[model samples]
Target: MDAFAIQRQLTGIEPLNGSNYTTWRTSVDIMLGFLDYEFVLYEEKPAAITEESSEAVKLLYAKWTKANTIAIRLIRASIGETIRGDIPVFNTAKALQYYYLTQFMSTSYDGSGSVREHIYKICKLVNGLRE
Candidate 1:
């Protein structure tokens, strides 16, 4: 896509909801790719280039770095609120991955002994294992 289209898409990105972390994360990655920005997942913040870098190069790097930071902040704010106390304040994408894996895929339903409860538990177990 063109620059304007990519910029518009990035600016229009939505915050993540509880159940859509995977979808939202995928969308963000696609948008970043459109803009030629790195996904920056599971990594420390990038280091700035040396003093020998040209003004235009520095500016581009700075803008790319800002966009990466914004993505992480948006992720933490969106997922953190949805998961509540399950996540800590200084969260990361790795933590979100773990939470997504354990919580959403968990099959430990607490239903008491009944036909429906048995069915749900079995389904949950199967789905959890599949995940």
Candidate 2:
């Protein structure tokens, strides 16, 4: 399949910049699903193009890597820095998503930041629990 065909299927989801990891994760996941790009999240094989691989598989792998690269670019700088070492050296896109979900999804509110930030976190915690 042509790459643009798949790219056109993707939603115009905003890049994640750490301001709202929860929403960003959700949006990106939905967008990826819409584009049928979930393999980048689950598969460990097809890491790179191999001489033995067929042309179709090679194209699919290229799409997968492109999706991952786009996602990596969307990540906010600070968030990226925080997770830089934690992200798997190989097969990063899916691993990065998992890292953010595990680290930020269950964060506790310590009332340490600005009032607005604290309120947002408290609301986030409440919303997360409700979900």
Cα error, candidate 1, residue 40 (Å): 1.5
Candidate 1, 16-91: lDDT as tens digits: 5444545666767676566555455545544578889888878867775776666556545444354444444433
Q: Please give, for residues 37-108, the per-residue lDDT of candidate 2 as tens digits.
A: 655666764657779989998998888778776655433322435434434443556564454455466676
Error of 1 at 51 (Å): 9.2
lDDT by candidate, in order shown = 0.54, 0.55
Model 2 TM: 0.43
Give me candidate 1's TM-score against the actual structure. Answer: 0.39
How well does candidate 2 score on lDDT at residue 70?
A: 61
RMSD of 1: 7.4
In candidate 2, the residue pairs with backbone N, CA or C atoms under 3 Å apart (3 or more residues apart, or in different chains) clash, namely none
lDDT of 2 at 77: 27
Backbone collisions counted per model:
0, 0
Cα error of candidate 2 at position 118, Å: 15
Which portions of model 1 miss their true places by more than 4 Å? Answer: 1-15, 42-67, 77-80, 84-86, 89-131
